[model samples]
Target: MIEATNLAYRIEKDSMGERQIPETAYYGIQTLRATENFPISGIKPLPTYIDACVLIKKATAIANSELGCIPQEIANAIVQAADEVLAGALRDQFVVDIYQAGAGTSHHMNVNEVLANRALEIIGDSKGNYQKISPNDHVNYGQSTNDVIPTAIRIGGLLAIGKTLNPALASAIATLTTKADEFQDIIKSGRTHLQDAVPVRLGDTFGAWAQILSEHQQRIQTAATDLTKLGLGGSAAGTGMNTHPQYRQRVAEILAQLINQPLQPAPNMMAAMQSMAPFVNVSSAIRNLAQDCVKISHDLRLMDSGPKTGFKEIQLPPVQPGSSIMPGKYNPVMAEMTSMVCFQVMGYDSAIALAAQAGQLELNVMMPLIAYNLIHSIEILGNTLSALTRQCILGITANSDRCLAYAEGSLALVTALNPHIGYLNAANVAKESLATGKSLRQIVLEQQLMSEEQLAKVLDLEKMSTVNG
Candidate 1:
């Protein structure tokens, strides 16, 4: 260790070369090299991922000590250090970039080094004293990056979906459901291929949106179940070469206790190590959800298009000024934002799918990319859904008069005369209404195709909008 002017450097070496790490950093040489090498994304790994890694370390320490694989003193110190991390300490210590070494070796080593150094401090030893508690020999006693990285990603992803995304989705669903009920009686002109169609209840449209999201929420929860099957004890090549026979089971139990989720070991370690299909499944579900979000946001944008020149059938809450030059102009900022997020999530799903397919025979080298993209999708979509619910969906106001006017004036209203007059006659009425710029009811009444009482019954907008048994 060398003390320079205002900056202290600790010398650390690996097979590649020697590097000086900051004396205050819990991370060591491997993490230093990773930061130097991968500056691609300019974003660090998420703190939730770090938390999952630390929890794995703590569980590993407890499991190893219980199995007599490490001394009690060392295990106790490591657990204490990892506990500090779990409590949100030393967050900046995990400094590796989101884009880093294959299989996330740099990330695994970064956590190991941090835990090792903190354990040293707990044992009254200075930092960088690998002799007292080596990152590999003690902190990573029975694990390999191949197993740890994927397991950590799964753990982190599941927690995020459960704690954040699921609730956000539920809130969105609730808001849409409420809107559906509120708009149940508001009949509007429905469009197909951007052309006027028969009338539909605005509530039915909102209910359909809610149903789509509810299905997505269920799919996400189901896919997350597969994440709980972990590949923890499969060392470098999924052979469990160095770990004890009971290490995997013991670690799963400890992890279940720690996270309050019942994690279990994979039935076949080799299959688990070589395949990332579970993650791909979850990503596919997220992609489906993103697709739905894009549709809903686009629909909202179209419905709220203009106060003067566009549909203007519904009004979104004005959250911000949409333009710099236009006065009193409020855009559908939340809907646009949600659409952009959904597009990004779709891109991430593609990346995740490609990464999942690139796995080789023994181990997948694209775990780091998978972890980064999966967690990012979950976090951003969660936040976006929450914002869409509160800032946009919940505050939407229907232009009932506009909706009624559109419904009353639409040529499609001629369809109601089909049962009474006939399809050909109704078609003529629609064509004549369009040609003369007269309403369908006006054309029918002027032509005397039906009596006034019969026309009123045939043109009952509310009954036309209602679903027939």
Candidate 2:
């Protein structure tokens, strides 16, 4: 037993012993012990994840009541408590650290205890009176941490993708597509190996980014489809022990109705509880998207590099002063931030992958890590993309004069002349232009490789930059 030096307390007992829980707290002894045991990361369970667990409890309460596993009045109180939590009450009651106990038993108990205590209140009883509305006997009657945690992960992933990531991606793709159309007429120098090679439309660059993001969006959606398969009814070791015969299908059906998604029970309960492959698939998809986002962000930074000494072909909107030391310095801060967030998402993916493969014979003890990392990755990536779209992508402006200058001055213009003057002759002209500082047209005319009108027609920058021009 333990006591705070200066607070009102109530005594609660568990298998090991008894402890003094805060009188005002909805969580019971099990949760109090977990908070003491794991002071690891101060991070709490995510709200979306909390919602997932609460939704599960609500569905189970309904199922258990319907199947005569529990009294309907107790089920009503439990469901009422779940509704209150879903509507944003008792959020602070979930006090366990995200890194607690193998298989997230600590966090699971935290949820059960909170709802149980709250339900007690709704039924004219005080908190910690589990005898009347037991957290284990009623709230979590047909569930175990093994089954609950995995199902929570699936539900949380689906919710995050639907409510956050997908919408953000769609907005970003739309913004990039609009930019692509807006900049299509502007011609810029295209480079290979950091050296000028040919002319390209600035719009095509943005259009390609839009296409890449759209493709990634498709991949992520495809990956999320696997999350709909759940293992909710696989109580403790996947045997459906202590649960009603109809509990599995009934609870899944109720949860599907509550979440408004087509959630179905896994065909093999044990396999669903044992393997973390579905999470790995979604994490891998997010990682793939992050990799491409990093590339795109780098491209943006390079294109917006300098007003005096860099590409400066496009100007990212200046959201803030770039440096304290230098005035009038506006950096590509949004793109820079996008890259940083993407790198973090990639790191989370790695952690999730390791945790996914670390499962033992029956249950993976690393679920806490996987749950936190995967869902956090999705949420952060979505937020970063939304900010980038609104603050950077939408406000971008083209430097038409600079783009034209780069295009007109590039020695790659000789590329078009290759057909007219032969490859060797064109190479010689390019070499002369670089060495003598003469224009490609001037060098070509000096060599008399083609008529002036022919050179004019062949070496047109506007024609060369436009598609199929």
Candidate 3:
């Protein structure tokens, strides 16, 4: 029997025409089964997204150049076919089972086969004619499962940042920045352990939000940069055995150009091919970003808690009917969803760590699960940012009356008064205000702590919000 493993898994043009796989045929049915089988956390990675599309194309090209390892011509055929698919051709033929043992090797071949058949149609040849190109031989010459999966994932992560994550984060930060500038003078209560603690400007609160997101962006970007270290040069393991030495660099260069993303050879091909630590690092970065997101969302929801029943410092846009039966009721629905996304990202991170831990040498064959987890986390993060930007941040409007009201009554005002009157006296003023049903202003005035004019000037909101001032 001829071993086609080393050749690109291509179906060349034979006199006998080939058969086209139906969308509802074995492949599609298997995809369904595999998806169901990996229902570990109910996380279905968004394979239909642009990032996935670009990744498949780039990997296909890489596999084709490394064609001898699999099937060089098959790789070429897959590249040709996938290019068309990426260019808006042939949608149904790629229906394949996703739960193969060797990372996404089967899925990758399915793509090649589908594309090759589609390409044949483009050239007026019947489908399944194994004469010209096969999926394994031409398409996956020098590549192995160890190399292609990581490369696809890295590019996908980069694309997520460039196209999705950064845009949403920019909008969120922009909203907070604008609010910070606007509320620079608005003094309000700061809290520790959910208790009123000190005087703080509302603007300062927003400035902190902007800073957190900025820091998250930086951290995730760095982590994603680590992912750019490609395993393409590390065939099977790190030795590049059974592959041309130049094939590694050549494939990497070609893929980098094709994907329009800068990529470099992994410093240690062995490490890149052996374990899933890079994924763990990237997932950790995503989780960190998610944690920051949860913090912001929680704070915003608290600030907009209630007009009468709670401390209403800000107002959020009501996207849905918050209450099932209550009248005139609204909630921070977007914030709640954002919080959920953060939690999901955290879960994905844990999955990454666990999966990485299970890898034993020369390869981590848990490709299907690992890729799914990473891509799912990235997708949720992108969607969450979009939600926060459009449904929450942009929709948010200031509740000036509520803010001022809360500020007037808060014991936190005692902080500013303390600098002038001492902590004990300020505390007494706050305690007395609560007892007498009087505002902080009234207590201050009644206690003869300072003249009204002096209080007004010192209570200026803008001055409270400035960091340098």
lDDT of 3 by residue, 1-469 (tens): 0112343232332224432233222122223334434444442234543345445454645544564444444455456666666676545444333345456664555554555555555556665553664444444445566776766677667676677787877888888898788877666767788986655778788888999988888887888877777887676777877677676676667767766777878888988877787788888988988998899899989989886787677788877777889988888988999999899889878877887787776777777667777877877797788878888877666676666665655677667777888889988888887798887788788889899998987776556535674
Candidate 1 is scored at a TM of: 0.96
Cα TM-score of candidate 3: 0.82
lDDT of 2 by residue, 1-469 (tens): 1235548889999999998888988989998899889988789999999999999999999999999999999999999999999999999889888987889999999999999999999999999998999999999998899999999999999999989999999999999999999999999999999899799999999999999999999999899888988888899999999999999999999999998898899999999999999999999999999999999999999999988999999999999999999999998999999999999999999998888889899899999999999899999999999999999999999999999899999999889987887899889988999999999888778778889999889987778877762
- Highest TM-score against the true fold, candidate: 2
Query: Residue 232 in model 3: shift from native, Å?
Result: 0.8
CA lDDT of each candidate? 0.91, 0.93, 0.68
lDDT of 1 by residue, 237-324 (tens): 8889899999999999999898888799999888888899999999999989999999999999999998899899999999999899
Q: How accurate is candidate 3 locally (lDDT)?
A: 0.68
**Where's the lowest-lDDT run of ten residues in candidate 3?**
1-10
RMSD of 1: 2.0
Error of 1 at 267 (Å): 1.0
